[model samples]
Target: MTPTTIRHACIAALACAAMSASAHGLKPMSDDELSEVSGQALLSLTNQTYDGLDFTRITLGADIQLSANLSKVRLGEYSYTARNGTGADIDMGLFRFGRSDGTEAQRTVNITDPYFEFVYKNAADASKREVIGMRLGFGSIAGDLGVQLNAISGSLLINGGAAGNYDSHNDPLGGKRWDGTTCTSTCGLTLSQIGQLTAGDASGASRDFFISVLRQAVNFPGVNAATGAPDKALEGFWMNWRDRLYAPVLNAAPPPNLPKPPG
Candidate 1:
């Protein structure tokens, strides 16, 4: 089954458990009891507000290892741009993580605190309440990301280089070369030339990443795909974050020795 389906199934199971507990006379565990637990919950829900937006966040607490593939993925399709068909910020096919023939560790993506967050504007008014955006992020990730793109409208930087085939002459994949001695302008690298894309830092260290889609287009600074120059591009979808997606610090010190949970 798909990763999304599996995740939703888990959430449904948790909801049913919560309902069953409410239906029965089961009392919630005390903080001390909860503290003694060795494992985290499978799911958690949180609601909050910030910057005039209301956020409903569903977080999956497990540290997961998974392998999956998507036949196609199209995000933020709006106006029809000649260079970007369907006007999508990200339009790709055969998106996959890991390899089928690899070992378990090699074929699996390690993800922590996977979360889905929905942003709403005018949430106080029923008729006016609308979901303005949604995002999927991981507190941290370590994995391989395989994809084939038909078109992309926003910035997707990798290894400190931009992913596109545009040049200052507005040519596709014909911009200043990568040799650094070329046009003395911006360099554009196609997905192929960028090689296998791995989710990590320059040193291959794991890090946080986020993928988001919004109703309103957000202007972001990126290389002009058509002209190979730095410019602002408006897009309603984007992936990868230059900062942390979630925190509490991944390498925080463990608490002092405590009693283990009852067997």
Candidate 2:
């Protein structure tokens, strides 16, 4: 063929290839396709795990349209429950991860919701740090140590041994003393006992303090006390802080107010 003719042929072929690509949408690399290219099918690729029994795969026809409804059908999973005496199918596409061989991986997509979200950036975010510091200050004041003067007095007095007195008479700044009882005998009370005696001051005040500190550090608005839990607005902040700080500390610390619950 002449040079001009060959150039025209190449242009037409390129256009056809582009149109084909656009029409099919991008086909994600399935296990087989991934194995072919990468030489291994990496299960749990999304750093998530699931029981193998929960997942099933259905192949899709090449001609299926790329609309949302069609995509949902392609990713749907069947559900059966004995209790309901009914079988229902759920859209598996709602699940961002899927399992094969009991291992889960994130769906290959441009956007996905991570099962565990971590915000490393918030750690260095200056505004977050300032907010957290302020929150911690409030938390400290409202906490057991700050609110329960009796507990503080008890702890201090008991630690002071024979010198323990409530009068604060002879020694102005010195520890208080109890005239009827000597604290030296009972001074060895466990930390849990101390916590219990102070518990009435604020139910989960210590925990709230820690949570507040974290919220301030990450620039999260205050938590809703009425909800008895962190609010949804703090979800992202909590997710990030928990992964980075809270989880690790809780794992390391002895159970809060521990020594086992009273029988």
Candidate 3:
């Protein structure tokens, strides 16, 4: 059967399976069980595509703790860009499922490189360092940079060498300067940390700032999965920040557009 037909068949099968599971006295599992089941489902879904095609990679049980009330799940795909830069596309799929037990199951398929990989860390001094490193590599947070800063700004600042300023003598990677003063290895400043320094009611504000910056830097449109509608706030923030910070990178000469001569 053609790939499309197979995909349709798989969807139908999954629907039937779901119904059967519900009918069988199979009570809903806990969050952990649900996560495992959903992860397995997603893998099955991926394999079903193109006659059991294997994925380049699969990251199972990735944790995305958005909040006490929300749960997140993710899947990723990896592939080379097309030779001509015209048809090559990578897939990065994300699934956000709500959870009451701090554990939930979700699934995705045909995902390329995801725009973001949200990670949760324990609340400790060591964890703070880990978060700081992530922020530097991934850019800022998504929603709380105010009207002035956005995701792109955060990305450029972080990946584009903004964090370097925090380092001694402006080293992009924090390292001890020649003079011997150690750079701030733990540069992460949480909302509580910020509140201690600043005055306003900035509870969780640091996280918001980080999210806004990351969204801007990543250039993600924040499309609604159900309706595929553009998230206005996210789009505007990305565009505005891109123009200011990432424009130079975007406008820079692309690698010679040499496509492998029609194989």
Candidate 4:
């Protein structure tokens, strides 16, 4: 064919490819691999052992879409539930998902309806305000110290995008800078006892700080549906929307009663 003719043919092919891409959608590697009814995530509390109570798993799947062109997986109306039917109900709350599995990509992961409930084993003090994401406050996002994304080459199954190099970890409990890591102890406390600890503080305040969300990463290691291999993790994740949350108010009289500083 003549050079002009060949050029025209290439242009047509490129246009066709682009159109096809827009018409189709991409899903996570796990979604493509597993034939289960819904997306699932497994946690090995004792290291790859599920026959015991230490192992926990949850269901994670929704209208998840993937885009190879953007190198991102966007969760559209996604919500994760407890596989055992007695765990937290979590969901991603945002759309513009960026890559979080690289050295320098902006990972802006927003959360919604997040929860966490685990036994606080061996805590030295119980009267102090417990916090998560850090015990000393302020460090690198590379470590699983608090509520952050899974590291590259790790199997944490962050159901979002492939990954870039941006660290965006704004913990709901702590804020942008925090280090007080402590989970509310629920291991041996009865229902009534647990209430005593968090309900009526020494100053007569209530447990309205938050509903206590379990900031966890839905990890599905061992088998991935995408590469058909055991890739430590599926990179990072991102939601496709946002919503407002509501709760009953407490301590409404604080501002009115507190001493006014010198104007």
Candidate 5:
């Protein structure tokens, strides 16, 4: 082919291509059409069914650092058996997580993939459906925790008590820490009454921490307040979501307990 003819043909082809591209620039999809499309997101939601229950789980794909403090906290106040007839499932004067420092990373609790799971019973039948339980959880966590328990219904277990750690100065019932020498007369309580508590997991990683509040009343076996006998009492159900809780010393002493519960 001649050079002139080849050049002319190339110019015509380029013009045709530009015209076709302009004719089909872009078009917006309608709402109906867009609904058919699928996409991925940083957060995912899923529904699962197992054992006659339905669960909706929301998972996040990110890390979080949190430093929180609650001066006065109360949950499930319906009974009048605990804390000298205070009638609370869990009541605390102070609750704190993590620590504050000049650096933000150092001051915050490290958490990964925070999630919320909602559980329902008879989900398919709305008339008979009910929310059985819901929970907020972390895939993993590493942080510091401090708490001042004024009143509680469930039992708490702490490890390693070597006397001098528990006393009855703040207790109204004239409680005393048991010393071997005092076995002749006065009975004293130990720092930990529920025995040693295990925290974290077998792999030594602190993971799967969650707090669950159930609709049903769960029985917590504990010493009877009136008879001091081993008995199980039904109270609002609550689940713990921490590694371990250290006992705070009373009376504002060195290494004192968290601030007192708000009146």
Candidate 6:
């Protein structure tokens, strides 16, 4: 081949290699595949009874469908079988389900290289740090975080201040308020309830701050399961917390004798 042609070929090969190296593990589930998965997950949960509550048939919600996302959205709806302590049937009409496994084949999280702001939220005490660190649990929590973070409709639930849940106000991945979603009457968690999207860069900036930190509380750096393994939180966290809370009476002697048995 000619010199110019050979050089161009080399450049093209290198570019292809780079693109391949930057790929993600997210893949779009086929309709059938999603259906099967959703069904399996739903079935596994059916006929199960909570200690104080009983629910009726579980069925798919209208919004349950595949998205332009790596994860599938499986919304489900159900109501109570009978009145409980509340004295009424407060049907959990619809709730989102986490369906993505972290082993998808394309379009996934670039967790190692995400552009993050060093958001320094105050930790009220050492317990908060322990709690935050422990939350990055393995499949139990971190996998779920990965699934949610990559969801097209990922949410950030505000704990109070009349904010039900910031469901659609965040970016598909970063969970940032992207310029708009007007909340004239109610800034709620559902799409129908949202007022409008961020109008422009300036408006978006303000909204980003508002939603990113509405009723702000303690927040720490979020751990990405894709980057590193999460810690075993139950034992590790509890023991550490106990040490911090309890005083050490070093080299203390045991009781002199076995105390009389309790009556």
TM-score attained by model 3: 0.17
Model 5: colliding residue pairs: 79-87, 93-261
Residue ranges of candidate 3 with Cα displaced over 4 Å: 1-155, 158-235, 239-252
Model 5 accuracy (lDDT, Cα): 0.49
Top candidate when judged by TM-score against the true structure: 1
**Which tens-of-lDDT digit does each residue in 136-219 have in candidate 6?**
111111111111211111133322125434433333322222111333224344332332111112211111111121122223
CA lDDT of each candidate? Answer: 0.53, 0.23, 0.23, 0.22, 0.49, 0.25
The collision pairs in model 6 are 25-104, 26-106, 179-198, 179-204, 180-197, 180-198, 181-196, 181-197, 181-198, 182-196
Question: C-alpha displacement of 76 in model 5, angstroms?
Answer: 1.2
Model 1, runs deviating above 4 Å: 1-39, 82-87, 100-104, 123-128, 160-188, 201-205, 217-235, 241-263
Tens-digit lDDT string for candidate 4 (37-104): 56434322212431121222222322222211111212212235312111112221111222333222
Question: TM-score of every model?
Answer: 0.55, 0.15, 0.17, 0.16, 0.51, 0.17
Question: Which regions of candidate 4 deviate over 4 angstroms?
Answer: 1-54, 65-220, 223-263
lDDT sort, best first: 1, 5, 6, 2, 3, 4
What are the per-residue Cα lDDT tens digits for candidate 2 across 17-117? 99999989977777987776643232222221122111111212121111111122111112443211111211111211111112111111111111111
Please write out the lDDT profile of model 5 over residues 1-263, one tens digit for every residue. 99999999999999999999988997889999999998657798978675456778788968887667767777766644434334555566666665443244435556777888777777566778787767666666665545555454333233223432332322343221111123222223332232222233344435535555667532221111322212122225343332343333322211212333468
The local lDDT score (0 to 100) that residue 209 gets in candidate 3 is: 19
Q: Which of the two candidates, 2 or 3, achieves a greater TM-score against the reference? A: 3
Q: Candidate 3: deviation at residue 68, Å?
A: 38
**Residue 169, candidate 2: alpha-carbon lDDT:** 20
Return the number of clashes found in candidate 6. Answer: 10
Off by over 4 Å in 5: 1-40, 82-85, 101-106, 123-128, 152-205, 217-237, 242-263
